[model samples]
Target: MKFEIGEIVRFRKKHPCGDDRWEILRTGMDFKVKCLGCERVIMLSRPKFEKSVKEKVEVKE
Candidate 1:
């Protein structure tokens, strides 16, 4: 799966805020993601990020 900036992805695990959705901020060796629920930002390694992704969401806009 190709991950791009501004893309929304669902994770296998739910965040503390109860949302499993995350927005891709920066993608490279590491991925920067913002939680859709709490709007909190975090970084994950490429492998880990890919492994945790449940599905890729098509952004309406």
Candidate 2:
């Protein structure tokens, strides 16, 4: 699973704000993600984040 900063990803579960989409802010041993719905930021361990990811939302280059 390759993730880059500024990429949008869909999670297996919905966020508290009811959105399942998140934007990747930082990626490494841990990932910094922002909630698209509430603009909230959260950090999760790489392994945990990977397991929660359902799909990577394609970004138009």
The global C-alpha lDDT for each of the candidates, from Candidate 1 onward, is 0.94, 0.94
* Backbone clashes counted, model 1: 0
Give the CA lDDT, 0 to 100, for residue 22 in model 2. 96
TM per candidate: 0.93, 0.93
lDDT of 1 by residue, 8-36 (tens): 99999999999999999999999999999
**Residue 34 in candidate 1, Cα distance off native in Å:** 0.1
Residue runs of model 1 more than 4 Å from their true location after superposition: 59-61
**Across residues 25-61, which tens digit of lDDT does each residue of candidate 2 receive?**
9999999999999999999999999999999886626
True-vs-predicted CA distance for residue 42, candidate 2, Å: 0.2
Q: Which regions in candidate 2 have their CA more than 4 angstroms from the true location?
A: none
